[model samples]
Target: MSEPESVKDLVVVDLGVGMPSAIVAKFLREMGATVWRVAPPAGDPFESIYPAYTSWHSGSRMATPDHLDELLARADVCLIGGEDHPGLEWSFEGAALIAANPRLVVLQIAGYARGFEQRAAVDLLVQARVGLAFEIFSDRPVNFACPLPTYGAAIQGLLGVGAALVERERSGRGQLVETSLQQGAGMFLSCLWMSIEDTQSVNMRNPPKDVWAPIVRCADGQYVFFVPRYNGMDKVFAAFGIDKSIGDTAKKGYFGDIDLFQRYATKFTHEELLRACWAADVAAEKVLGPGECWDDEQVRVNGTIVTEVDGRRRVGTPLTMRAVQPNSGAPRTSLPSAPEDAAPLAGVRILDFGAMVAGAYGSKLLADLGADVIKVEPLAGDIMRTASYPNFVVSNQGKRSLHLDAKAPESMDVVRRLCATANAASHNFRVGSAGRIKLDPASLRGYRPDIVAVQCFSYGASGPRAMNAGLDPLMQAYCGQAVRAGGRDNAPLWYRNLYIDYATGAIGAIAMLFGIREQLCHGNAVEAETSLLEAGLFLMSELIQCADGSFSGGPPLDYDRTGFHCTECLYQTKDGWVAIAARSDDMAARLVNVLHLQGFPENSRSWGDSERQKIAERIRSRTTHELLQQLEAADVWCEKCNENGWQSLLDDPTARAANLIVETRDPNVGALITVGPLVSFSRSRLDANRPMSVPTGGVDTREILGELGYSSTEIDNLAARKVVA
Candidate 1:
């Protein structure tokens, strides 16, 4: 994957609203693609909804709608909000546009599942409908502060576009790509399905118990997210007069109780406690928003976390694509080609040694898209299995599992043999861990000289905190997401959504797809990388630097604390809750007129506590159905947050109609219901119905070795020697 200096040869037309479509265009623009936006000015990301994000992309512009045909003629990809935003001059029809440009890839982004699309494409509603609130906490659906589903949709969509481009190189024809907030939300919602298999475990996990409540309050009143999971943390806890109940390792392969120091934590100041935690190898960091983390030494030095894009500090691109250096006299191998009517990556093979959240999500996505991803694991099995069984199955499903211990030299030889049959590889090893096992990307080249390797981790590849252990919660605390919604003097509010963890996986997949494109188009092997920190920033791309040395965007929770602004916020109705995203004055006017709102101020800034209370009272008197009808009729975005979300999944009729929800029956696990691959292609299938292989645990060892030409006696000898589990 030769990542040449520029992607100036590619052109993209963004005709969508909000972050999902905008972020995709921004990435291509950052990579030198000619991006043109011809959207309704009010909702256009380039103009109003997120000027803070577009301001930095000076090269991107909002072209006139009349020029859609011209842009489509030469555009490699055209992103649209939905069927609603069709071209006024020509109907902006997907079929018509693709017909005009046979090579153009059209991507449609919506809020609901595919067949159920006309439901207002609002992020909050989608998050609510998917039972996000319940998934993280109680059994009832509740409202979420941020549009996390939107971010998840964007990254998945980004991968979709990239994969389409790679597939186009093979079939020489373009296709229609479809994705939605439901599909995006489903990525992290994988755990919901776990209840069907292991109800007890799902009942036990109550994710994200607070707005950093488990946080240690230092003497100075600053908050530190401390998870005392170090090897000798139990002794350190005793020394500090903290709780010593979590003796030895805190839950091996998972986090320990964070409240162990809650009672005694205030004895030390923030810095003092931080230093102590670091010295003791305990995971701890001061809680800060995305903007505050911008100045951290590790963040600034690595430059990707709060990167300077055109002199403005912004959450830059998540992917780092570099040209691979071929050996002195060898040529890169030609990339594999997908068979006609097959999935986008049909013939592509991946040796995935990745496990846990980020790695599992990314490679599992690759597995769904027809990549022969071999889930290579050590004999001890993936620790995620021990930490959360349901979580493990959701991420590990749809792929073949093999147990090959990387530590054993003989096992490593078998790993090398598998690598020779793979064109791509990935891992989430902590910094420097892979090299020791001879599984690093550079080391992989010795087996498949032209392999495209994707390596992911916390922090950066080479920073002071590079070797430090980190997780989803720490990322939220460090990069500001945890503080985005809570802290009503609560100090540090954490989100229940594992959005950053999920997005990191999608970004990793994006990097992998980009490398695949490089391999397919230019016959080049590449080294691509992404991180949780980078993915977290990308989710909050609204945060940006301004000329006055001040940053703008990523507003805190509103007065109601349910959304950012009054007009674009959540409200409780007679029967349920409804989310509204009528940000622009035009849409707000429609909302007021439709709801027969009286004494409503034109500016949300004018709505103080009393005014908000009055409006809330009025809305609370009306049924959700009445409000949805009146609001949507006037073009105002609104949706009744899903109240029966749990049961809804049992028979998601719309998802089934759209083929977004499918089933696979395993010999041992019976029938497994899942939120299948989000991206849908008109020309090819994504193999969403593929059954998950049981956790390998050496079940496939003999077959895998036999495929590599190992004799039965040789395999018996290897097993006898304990090389292959």
Candidate 2:
């Protein structure tokens, strides 16, 4: 398939700084949009330092701020980075821009949701606030070596832009769309924040005990990670010359005892164990550094990592849609316009067969866009409903629920009927499970030839471990993420949050959108697939590249002891803590003046060890408030560390003004305050006043069946037969 013409006429003005903004532009460019990137007269600070900029900013035109008015005159969308960043003052004039061009979609990115919008924040500080820092290193807060928060925020920003464009198609007017690092982090880690009936039953502070842990050291002193399935454990044990029955007993007795398992695992070399596991058909892999992933055969063959014509290597977006065929001469169908006051996906219908985080979150994203989502549940309902109430509520909000038994023949007919009415359907069942339930693409297509089907799994559909059951932690370990972030000495720690699951959901949503675009361009359905493994790769892409055919993992020379680059790190102040990022020369100079570092050079590398220590000491002598005031006056990037947790945002002026938080009463959980929608359109913003409620499974089954042309008598018979709940 060729690139769709839908975005060909769209002109995007990218005035944001850094990789996040560049990422949004890259997605637009991929969809054939014309992006004109407006930088300062002096150019981006990272232009000469970061190779990611080179990769993300490719295929775009560059302009200076002087052309802002001219660019806005023709732009359909404008992406603005944080307000305090150098050369981004123009982005603050959203009201003026909309007055001039009422149809312009202005997307602003910020560090915090509201009150702290003007404060300087980098990826490190954002990660710290969201618990990533503390999660990665148990002893103290340490930022990931890569900028994951930035990427997360960027993906949300991209979704905002896409939704706004869809809204514009109907309203013919553009609006302001805003997303922040804090908000994105919350969404990315939704599963972790979930509340259950008995919180004590599941401990977020420690690793899960049921699944076998993946980390093991080899005789060669290298770490290897693998998820050994229970059924395959016998084979793995046999290959290692251990009695299967004895090994099973040991596993059952010492399930959560890491020390005991390690003692047993060390009996064999890492290479030997990995070979045995692979031979036994268990899901296993040697832990690889970011750079080493570039050479992995699976990554290379799947085009997960690509080498550009300019010789720069970068990770590719996991979401893929076939291009429109050239010279086919098929007439393109224009998407129908939404009605006034309609949501972006007002007319779209989605079938939610998702369970847990990956599947349900994808459907929730669509539901937020105003799609009519019918959540199909089993007779007993979604397992998460009982396991985690918060997870069930957040994932199924704004959708109607129906219950059916997939094993019943009559229920399969109901699923087919529903498929005939849905524009798309998504599920995260293991490979072949969808076929067993008659909801796979082949079966769904039999009902609706043009239905878009998205299937997500632990691994992808074609991998050797395609059918293996996996979770976020297991995938993280297997994909080298845990080892990379935890450093060499520590046992590979699972990310504190469900980063993989949320990322997979976001990617799945993108895939569904692309599939919809394909159907609009060509009258055919598309099957979209993504995996937790792919999400992990995309998150760690910034560090996954090779230049000299060699691979190693270590902190850069500029790394600070506080978990950020020297120019951007957390520091102690007299009264409290502050996070600073004096990335540019100008900002560095301002930082020097504010901190009274008399003899220190702007380049941190130029300072002697003693001099650097002295500078830190001097800064530590001042109060956090005083330093923040001084830094703001000097235009240096900095913010006081927010250790008060997410509740602090409740009183934030910017967050309130931007509608970043909302209060609603839930039938089961009572009054609650939750993060609001990531994007806000001038006309089609979600109704913050609407109570978010998830009805019990089968609550609407009878109504749904009635709508499907089944009479009361037929519905009764189906229910009596255990076909429909």
Candidate 3:
């Protein structure tokens, strides 16, 4: 392996128009790269009003005599985002051209793959390209209004680019990489996965006393969350203001059973009961709405929520990297800014062949960070364009869209041309027949050297189910999540939202970053891979029987529900509900005190034995609000489970101090809410925002083609052929 002289920044040469391209471009700029917008031949031009600048190379369109040669000659890396339109053969031609490139990189945007179908396609592409490429899959199957999932994938691509670049420094070569959507989805289903194995053990043995509590409706039309650990149970019993002995056992009388707790819960308003519980230091919380999450003290002060808008705040990045001493003599530059026009990856070029949530959202995240992502759409455009999304603007903030038929020779030619000038290209094909859209990474190298390609799908690109059609719901059922959610019952319920898909995207971003770091270490590119099944296994690791470890009798029954720890659950309250987890003895004792119970029951029953029913019957009567207040005041470990509201979040000043929201104006959408760049660099400062304006599909085609040296007449002729869609 030979290290490159230095890390050369990426230069973007956008070929299409849409939020995807804009997003990719935004990422480049944030990374302190340069951007050179390229106008395609058929776009509707309004040059004077646009803010970006472009180079004119009219004569060098895709497959033009020396187009590939010139692009590779001038650029260190090429990037691509989104996919080309259908009906156009350009995507296919582009695939071959890119496989031929020696220096270009590709980023695939397929969100989630069912089974292992996507993985197989990626493997084939890897074999064909014989160069560097990788896949990004959404954690789960998703159908949302906005492109929230795209953030996950875009961040992953940016990280991948960095890693691939580092690898190029080591091996002086590149390889193909891919991720599985099913795996991505599996990553986010951690809770459910753990429940499965727990339940399995419990099914084998039954106990008369159950400790877990369910979410119950309150009289105030609100919900409350509560949990009964040792102390909390005692507190609830004490709150009932009784020392009644259930008989049997030690010094006195006591009983442990869900029925006992139920009897007590029914006596008081949820709130009144909660106060008694809170005095005891129970783990509990009220559910919060999206906005309320921002206001959460933990969220606000923990620096986990980054605000990108005045009114919109979201979860922040949870990881960071420690910088190593430089091995080379080159001095480090200051942290890059995040401004739309002057940020890193500004001039970096990318070719996007992704669709739906996973691939598309991945590119979008990059755009937010200042990368020029060119979304090459099929004739019909990305399916998301017509998706029944509730938040369409979330993912499409900064990107450009271009429509081209990947199957058409001319369209493929266009894709080839774009790849020739891209720093990387990407694709996200699901595991089955849906993966037909993937391009060979090695083949792309034929058109340009050292190119990076990112690919994501359903299953692993190399597994048994590599070609199966997998989606979120299917993944849930297959992974044993549905079963866990249903508890003793076999009937499973699908989660209302596509959490797995989004989580996969997020994890993929982290992988991409790691891969890019490796590339920087070697003068070669590295392939990064992940799978849905692997993700599922990871999620359920706690529940799965390890090859080397013994089950040895799970948790104590007083706190366990089969495999489920019934103690960590939601509890009804007076005003609402709270989610709580009482795990320690101290916590349990505090709860008892808060409930105002004094002398211990005469019964010799241990903390979590089956002889504590008298305590259960007492706490059931209080209201959720009162319980939350009491618990919170006592510093109990708990929180509210928000079904969907934001009042509390918006009112939290701590959230504002944590930089959970930042204000920025968009060129295209005007003033709107945006989420995070959710990361904080202790050593390097980061500054970037979405662009003010984004282009629509084919909006700048003619102008871009003109720069490529295409004669006006030729440009018009191509439009007549409907080659540019």
Candidate 4:
């Protein structure tokens, strides 16, 4: 456990709960920062419930809020959580703290932003407000068994803080950083929000016809999940003794006659089916529930799960960077003056060969960090330009675009030449596609032996479905996420947001950063691999567990006609809907007092069916404003379920203060307002407020070629030959 040289002397103050703040503390600690965690007098609320809490705050020294001022005076960074907790008013306190400590870096995590900053929200509430619930359950809103919103936000928070730290290295100042569950939800479903086409408009929305659905019951009553590549479908059909002739047509029709295939699938046991599928080169895996993941061979081999010294099982960080060490030290608050024109990653150069949201977003992240990114595309442009312009804009910002037909010998030479000069290169092509274009790690390494290479695939590099084409929806269906979220009685549903894709993008960015760090430290290049499937598994890590008899699934679904639970979900009020959380004993007691429910028990579970019904009725009897006032005054967590559009966020003072939304004019889209950068810096600021406009295909082709030292005559000849655009 050697510490990273860059963060060797950093000190961080961890405030609030374990969720986002603790998660941030964990990452910094891993990077070699000494973390001092400030817990409330009653102790951290999640300490007893979430095992990850202990894992994240492992080496941090714990203290009460009384030491907050002293800690801040010596801290390089401070992570604050508990936006909804009544004991802390972060908005005002944060402002005061920053005023007092001009160089302090404060990162705050909240449920929502703007005018609703004071409102209480958890993962479940954020998911419902952002359309995840409606997408998962057609009848009503249901939270995933896990806390995806918070986890996703936590990842972004880490990235935001890291970027700010990079900026601080140059500017010698610290700034405030903020992120929220709502923002995380947007990133999770970046594709859905940006795409012009809605999922419901397609015939594939029906679960029966969803070609991506992978769960199939075998003869032995066991279940297996598999994803077949375009060409592998024929082998799958043949293994089941079905005519391969129908494979192409079935695929075109989104798995035509699903029932017939299911009937045929029943002939083999789960193990037999998996064996046959693997023999035929189809990627498959057993449908391991949350309780069964611990013993999984692949999971263990990948170090995705680890048993702590205390014997508690915990999830491990997916990305690995061996060159960097993990140790403990206090960071230096001041350093030598930096260059006036310094950018966070001014000296780094990256070659971008990705399309669609995942690869493009990863490159965009690098570009935002001040890396010189050159985007390589085909003559037809990235396919996503036509599929979703908004997505293209968001993912292609701050990069120079070039078009090259890799099939041509001249284009292949140009790509190799580019790789020689680049510090790193990234692509999201299906498994074998990179090799065809001579952009694979081996080929790129031939040009620059120490160059970093990053590859993103749908499934993974070694899985049976490694070469298969996949998207967010498909991965969700295959990983049992759709089934778990949809519940046992309902049809598996796909979340409209391409959360897995964006999450993969975030992970990809981290991997690239690690690669850069490795080169800086060890003077060696590294190749990193990540996939949508792997990211999905990581997101569900906290929930996956083995049931050892003591495991009892939390309270049964308290589904009402409106699709929310009475005790801990959204309820209709006189004016509008309000989301409330009164599941805990203290909160339940407060709710009982506020609503004047005479006979309702303070113990949440003691309430009978009739009592629950009475509470719902009483809640509906009052207006949203009245209920919010009563609940909030009584220290209960609640918020109005905002159904407004993104435009409304612009008017929020807190959002504006934090620079959460930026407005920029674009040549193609006219005036544009997009989500701003997640973090802020005092002396140096990354302007995410600018429109991330998409450049026309080959818009900078000649310019980039000129930089590559290609002669004018050669460039013209290549353009004439249709090799360069």
Candidate 5:
């Protein structure tokens, strides 16, 4: 089968009900694919939930559902909102979609993949069930302001679709791809989760507070944040004539005298501190309010935020692609697709120079897809390899590792040799670091013009903050998620956790897919990249603006630790807490009937103190499960907030059976249970038993060297010279 000419040659049908399906459809359209939105007569019932949806769906091709079957039969890809559409809640729906077009890639977006598939899967409930309530919000239970699970799930679902499409070029067949809001939450915490025998990992709220960056107020009472891992912060202080001691505090992750640092920081306004930090090469950003980031200069220049023709704001697509038409007689991108029993990416090879989680996790996913990934580590390995072995293991599992001192002149030879056999290369090294070592995309293109290359940056590769260190916390502070998540208190708090890091890694994986698709379908090699800031903005895409600078987000969460009102908020039961998501009027009426209340007042997003107290009292009267059963029976979305024990989620019987979570045995760790790839392929099989390969780092240096035809003496001499390990 010949490959389609390009994304422009393909037809994508979006039958999804909400943003999760829309996000993927938008991606395909941006990539030049013909996209059509097929919806119910009511269009999208919950489209009003996001104010930005007005702009997000601007000019979208809305096709009548009367021809939905014909559209699916002729489409190259189909996106179904498995979570929002009641019709897609069962396997029969997915099976029917795939059976409609055996050559179509059917991507079903849902709230949960397994055990709770039949439940109402609201993003807030998914986050609550996944234990994000205590970690993202304050220590006490608070409704996380962002719809994070759906945002992340949208990207994960896109990844699943891209990978399946790439594999289709080889197999000439389609597969069912599934992802959920629950899995989206899992993406944020995938690498951090660990399981061995009966023990499971827990959340890391106090993870490393200093690593959160100092959230300091400016002279005008506005807030700013600095990169925690950056070492040049003291230089910024000295440039501003502040005490270098306070700067040293920042360099040490604000270890000592935080108040002193805050005092010094307050001496400068956002412009003043930002200018000084730029001059000193210290990465910093102002803590923006919801929708304020739509005007950021850095994001503006990098096109992270763009303006539609009508001047409405929109987040840029995750992929920034550069297409290069192949030279005459160049080979095609399609390789022999793995057989029916093999993983989708069985024949692909990737050379990964990703250092930390931002760098490592995406390739970790590609590796999970059955690609052959070779980790090109510095002599000491990744900077964070020792920070947490479990993290490193999760991020670099199943890959061979080679240690090289890129600074050594001899190392270039080894790198070039590996490039000859590699289809792609990835890295998250500091800005200009790759160029200094001649490993940048342009340099590698000279070695393999058809290679798929991707780079991950803290900021983007251009614009004002491009040189910033890879700081996920600072991104949260900068993009306004921290402030939004902070809710009524509005301290702009951020956790030292996976906000943009893991998602950026996932985005990087998508960038890789973009390159690979270009090579396969377009007969071109592509260069694609994204940043922590850009990824964060994508996560916060709903916080947008209109032509007149009017904010698009709904009111900020004012009544902290709860939902918009009494009917929608979480309830403390006699046992523990259960979250209630009765945002719709119907659900709210059902909830009122169940609780025996006259219902909330007509004109308030927040409950008065006394009203809240009365609601809490009524909720606490029943056990959590009893209330949950009553609520579920009434068709109200409710979920119990879980702790880290939810980490062994892959061990759930339905999940394991679906291959959404697979059981693997590692020689070093006996039985290891890990999340199967977030996406599942119905026609293809994964090497589930070997999901994890090493107990520690890969010891494949000699083996890899031998494969490259390096002789024993030469390998020994290189090792002796400290050039290779």
Candidate 6:
């Protein structure tokens, strides 16, 4: 009720005329900031519903208002998440706005691109900027077509904004922070770069490229993605119970050739091979299909998959930050939008009906920031509930749930009633005629005139695939991600798991925050939409740029293996193998100087791939401990590459320090390791493992009925009829 005394009370603004902005606004509010949004001028609003369609503006058509400079100066943080083509009016203006905001912190979430225009575009927004400009994309790798996590980028984008605001207080100046969806997507495909660089080749023609971490189908027809490290191969060889003679690197030239290792790996059944691989700490896991993650013990225990909707739970967000101990000398960060506790979206609520991974996760993130997220599920629950792999417990933590078959008449009635309640007045806002929840624009208008509504359908709520079912995999196919993933040649391969789902979730959350911001500051509905297709393309923007040769700060893709030297590739040892990431000349010298190794090879063409293998073979003759000690002593950022994404805190000290994973308790699933915060915030910290106290589907229905002043008998009748989950 009191005026906000901190930064959380300031209003958020959504410049683009769409849902992504709305999502961003919603999250900002929940993070304790008021939001203000800007829609397209009247009826001439932008037509595209998806961020994918909206983000590709390349040319000069992007708007550059006469008062743009003033607008940039007025805001603390300005985010540009759309296209950079010069042909579009908005693109040029967006870039110009970044330059104009001398004191403003700007974040450009774009992809890696090539060509002069693309490079110029990068320069305009990111290049040579005072602050950080991050690129997240999926380059050409064995599993390049997988969904990238742009949704998380949105979270990072907002986090960048918050960080900028905090920095502004101390420095009295603003800095630029830029990232691209393509860059984020690229992170999923980094192994390709690792391989290209590791093999001491300018191009991807290295021997390792000849080999693949393939998912071989067993006689039972089950598939498992496998990529064995050095030690894993020995066990894999032993697992098939065969004598492949790959154990020692001294006699043969097998150490450098990954493809050679695969020849032997393909001999066993998929299941048999996996057991062997696991026993040897090789990177091998069943290629989880959609919805399959829910059934995994890791998913259940980690609280990634969860129960929802009349007792049928599904996958939710994978990141959580717990509440900070009150008054621990760590002053709570304040937002100008709302008062201290009320500072960040203190009284905001979100209704999420997204069935797939991305949308579902996006809503979960808002909840993490303190929004009351009511996860609306279909009668059968979210499709993710029945997803084959079923890792819902890890992603779906800490949220209330409700179920309604929107297609059914009675269920639709319940939805309408709930929407009506959302439209109604609350203590914080002026008493409204309607409540907040609404299925239609008209209903939302009457409900909370100042509220933001986030509708996260797969391809968005309209157009060709408006009614068509959408998810990460299909979208990857549609957006050319699968095609580009194959690189200049080769066949496209989709990355295992719900890749696009996580990305879409994060983007959806950004849109919600933008919409909510628009509502609180200059009350109006702010709509933005993002799809897997758009997100995929957005994250890979640099790829487009690179293909066109318009990127900057680095040469266009070139291939040269000469002048290369190092002990950086995967080294095999008798006990186990460890990957070495020590790649600098100094580090290389340190590896030789500190380890005090023998048989260091001399430089020359004579020491090509074949010779390089000879040196590696000699090194592998030692133990992992010996090599690790040598690298550690040299102070290189060396880490044993756990090809599998299963490194525990104990195994990886850095992961522990970054708080990448945590132990969380789930109502139905119990305690398990869940992924930690993607980005950390000193204050306004949400629990990494917040308790999901709301019953799967009990609270939403009960709360709504009670608020509608429905009698207990009526509520019981509805429950009996199964109108609510």
TM-scores of all models? 0.90, 0.84, 0.49, 0.78, 0.89, 0.51
Best by TM-score: 1
TM-score for candidate 3: 0.49
Candidate 1's C-alpha lDDT? 0.70
The sequence of per-residue lDDT tens digits that candidate 6 reaches over residues 1-725 is 21122335443444543222333444454334544443333321223222222222221133334545555567665655533322234432444655666556555554332111232122112211101111121211121222233443454566446444543443455555544433333223222221111222112221232333243555455555544342334654554454666445212332333444445545666677777766665555544323333344433443433343334332233222111112233222222353332213334566666554565666655655556666776667654443421234334555667766555556655655555444111111111211232354445444334334444444443344344345455554444444444433333334444456666566566555544443433334443445554454344432212223232111111111111222433344556544443333445545655555445444221233564565466666777677667666666534332333333232445444443444544344343444444443322344544553323444466775666577888778877877765
Candidate 3 lDDT over 1-725, as tens digits, reads 22222332554443423223334444454333454444444442322111121111111123322354565445444444332221112211224324565344444333222122222111112111111110111111111111222333344444545534433343343322222222222222211211111222122111111213222233443323444342324554565443547632122212244445545556656676556656665433332211233333433333433333222232233322222222354332212333322433444555667665555555555564455677777767665544422122334446777776666666656666676666556666654322343255555544444445555555455544455443444444444443344333222233434444544444444433433343334323323334443333222211212223222111111221111232233443444444444434455555656666656433222343222332333344666567767876875544443422122323335323322233345433344333433322111222443452334556566765665566889777777888775
Residue-level lDDT of model 2, residues 1-725, one tens digit each, is: 44445556679988887667777777777657899987766556656445566667777898877788998998988888742445443445666787899899888887776545444546766766655444433334555654666767777877777767756655678887777776676675454433334344332232332334546676677776655453535655554556554534434532233444456667778878777777777666666655555565555545667676756577676665443332344343344665576667777788988898788888787777777788899889887776555666667877888998888888877887787667789999988889887888778777777677888877677655566666776667666677666644555545546678878887787767656655564555667778887777777655524465543233332234454244666677888666777766677777777777676666654544465566578788898888888888997776666554455656656655665555556555555455556665656756555545566678889998888888999999999998888
lDDT of 1 at 294: 77
Return the candidate ranking by lDDT, descending.
5, 1, 2, 4, 6, 3
Best lDDT among the predictions, by candidate number = 5
Q: Is candidate 1 or candidate 6 better by lDDT?
A: 1
Worst 10 residues of 6 by lDDT: 554-563
Extract clashing residue pairs from model 2: 1-323, 1-324, 2-323, 2-324, 114-654, 114-655, 218-270
Weakest 10 consecutive residues of candidate 2 by summed lDDT: 202-211
Model 1, 1-725: lDDT tens digits are 44443255678898766677777788888766788977674443234556465653456876997787888888899987732221222225666778888899988787776667456566776766676644443433434555667776777788788778878877888888878887777776666544344344322243533323346678888888765452446645753566555464354323444554665777888898888877766677888865888777777656774434456667767777776756666664554665678998887777778887788778888877877778888888787766655666667777777877688888777878898888788888998998999988888888877677898888877777778887777888888876776624546666655667778877877777777677656555678788888777777788887656687888677544566666656688898777776655667667767766777777654555565566667789899888888887787877667655646866867666675666666554556666677788878786645665445455777887898889999999987887777
lDDT of each: 0.70, 0.67, 0.39, 0.65, 0.72, 0.42
lDDT of 4 by residue, 644-690 (tens): 43434556566556545555555555555555555444445454543
- TM-score head-to-head 4 vs 6, winner: 4
Query: Candidate 5, which segments miss by more than 4 Å at Cα?
Result: 1-5, 85-92, 115-117, 136-139, 195-213, 230-260, 263-282, 564-566, 599-614, 644-651, 654-674, 694-698
**Please, what are the lDDT tens digits per residue for candidate 5 over residues 1-725?**
22224666779887776777777777777666788877666456556566776555564677887887888888988887744532333223777877768898888877787555645667768777777665543335666666677877888888888778778878888898877887777666555455555233322222542234467788888887765333444565664567664335543443344566677787788788877776776666788877676666777877767678887777767557677665777766666645775787878888998887889888888887788889999888786655654566667777888888889999988988898778889999777888999889888877776787889888888877676665777788777887876667667766556668888888889878757776777667667788888888888767667788787774456546576556557778898888887666666667767888775765333446666677688899999889989988898788887755345465567767765555666655567666557776777666776546542454788888899889999999999998898
